[model samples]
Target: MHVLLISQYFLPETGGTTNRVASLAKGLQSKGHDVVVITAKPSHPEGVIWEGYQDDGLVRDEQEGIPTVHTWVYADFEKTLFTRLCSYLSFMCSSVLGAVRERGSFDVILAFSPPLFVGLAGWITARLLNAEFVFDVRDLWPDLAVAMNELNGPVKIGLARWLEHFLYHRADAITAATDGFCESITSITGPDTPVQRVMNGTEPEVFRRDEAGKKLRKEGGFDDRFVVTYAGNIGICQGLDHILEAADRLAEDRSGVLFRFVGSGPVKDDLQREAKRRGLDNVEFHPRVSLDEAAAHMAAADALLVPLADHEIYRSFIPSKLFDSMAAGRPVLLSVDGEARSILEDAEAGRYYPAEDGQELASNIRWMLDHPEACTEMGENGRNYARTHCTREAQAERMTAFLEELIG
Candidate 1:
């Protein structure tokens, strides 16, 4: 089977959607299916195109032996809603040209969505090629945008809602990243459209426990400190201000607990400013690192944090970072409710605090700090659960089978 995968993000761009699409492409290829990727040039988070693909035209590249087509994007650094839409729209238009450049019929066209324009482009491409179209939803947009206050005005909201419904109705099949998302899709399009939960997972082997983090601990003078690290995008949805407040509350306790952030996003600078203003000496920030380096950071920390803002739209979100943290054999400090909280409790891998609740977060941190043996047990439980249930290879194989079944 020949599969054309469309996404705004891909390998070398570190995020959940990129990881999901890349894993599926590689997994399909490993299973003897031909996979072709249509993605934008590598500008993400920072919005600066990576080196070697600086030209304003189509670039053909190979990612782990899978054929890929890189198209031009707007590369918006400002991150305003208009600029972000321009970025998504530019990729949406260019991805069609990239698909045209492929010049081959596909058995299936799989599109990943967040900006949702990529799904629009994939729908267009599928229609042009008369192939089966599968819409892979990572987030429920327009609803999420409205919750974030990013999409407003009746005309804009009406159009976005129309587009969302249109894509859901038009797709040959739909795959959601979470069960909540599955339910949401089902509610929107009803039983006519097939909706399956294809969870975001991690490569357990790549993220397994290691002592490499000891070197980091020694270098950073954190040998005596109890470290809790948040090692992904420090975005608006993260509600990191609560973490600062937690740190402040802990600062007076003299527990030697430190909070570390190891990623980048639009709100990173603002979060840093807020931390500094609040005199949060226990909180520190680092730039984003590669996946390998991220594993080391996780290993060095006593616990990993997975937080989401307090919003109803976030109830469905299982932050993809949680899997990697668990796979790395570290206990998680999960601060989200609903589906994610359920998973954490089921795995016995972590403790939860209500989102945006500094007092609760601080209390959890204190408990984690006080019970070292319990934390170790939690870490072990997490790793075991991740190995048994959340490997990326398993998810990819599941997705591949789903696609093959759809094709059949």
Candidate 2:
């Protein structure tokens, strides 16, 4: 089968979305399916194009053995609404034009969403090529936006719902990253809508704990202090300020608990300011690294920090960081609730704190520091669970089955 996979973000962009899309395309290609990935030219969370990579026009490249089509987008993670809209719109218009111009036929068109407008292009492309459409709901878009208070006003919300339904109804098959997402789509599109759960997972072969991880910590300036690490986009939905506040509560502790944040986003500067204001000297911040690098840091840390904004939408969000943490064989300090909590509790992976409660998080951190035996056991359990159940190779095979079913 031939596939045209479309997403706004792809490899080298640090996030679960990047891993999910790129890994699947490569996996399909390995299985003899011709896959062409259409994406923006590497500009992501920061919004600017990747260094040394200019987006002058449509660029062609190969990513993990799969052919790639790069479209120009007004990419920038500007705070203003207009600027962000332009970023999304440029990608949508350019991708549609590129899809139409590309010569050839495809068996299926897989569309990933967050900037839901891109689904329109996917639907259009599928119709244009008379191909099947598969919508991958990685994030429940406008609904998630509404819960995060990013989207408001009845008019806009109504239109977003309409768009979402239109695309879902048109899709020959829909795959969501979690059961919560599957339920959400089924509720809207009815029980008959073909919805499956193809969770976000990492390549186990690439992410594992080894002696080199310990060497990495020493080389990266980390020492014997008990380290609690949070590595990902420091965006608003992350509620990273709570982590800084938690650090404040432990400021006087002589146990040598060090908090480290990795990755860049809209709120990195503010979190730094808040940490400084509180005079917390134990906290350190680092820029984002590639996926393998992130795994190395996670493996080296004594414990991993998994947090999310305290909101209804986040209840359904299983932070992809949890899966990565498990792969690193580190006990997690989970600060979110609902689906994420269930996963950690069932895996016996780590302890959880009340959402948005820095004092609770602080207490949990201290507990994690003192109970080395428990942490070690929890980390082992997490690693076993991740290896046994969730793996990139397995997810790709499941997705392939869905494609074949839909195409037939």
Task: Assess each prediction's global lDDT (C-alpha) against the native.
Answer: 0.89, 0.84
Q: Among these predicted structures, which one has the highest lDDT?
A: 1
**Candidate 1 CA-lDDT value:** 0.89
Candidate 2, residues 115-169, lDDT tens digits: the string is 8878887888899899998899888988788876778899989998999999999
TM-score of each candidate?
0.98, 0.96
- Model 1 misplaced regions, further than 4 Å: none
State the TM-score for model 2. Answer: 0.96
Deviation (Å) of 408 in candidate 1: 1.0
Give candidate 2's error at residue 142 in angstroms. Answer: 0.6
- Residue 194 displacement in candidate 2 (angstroms): 0.6
CA displacement after TM-score superposition, residue 253 of candidate 2 (Å): 2.5
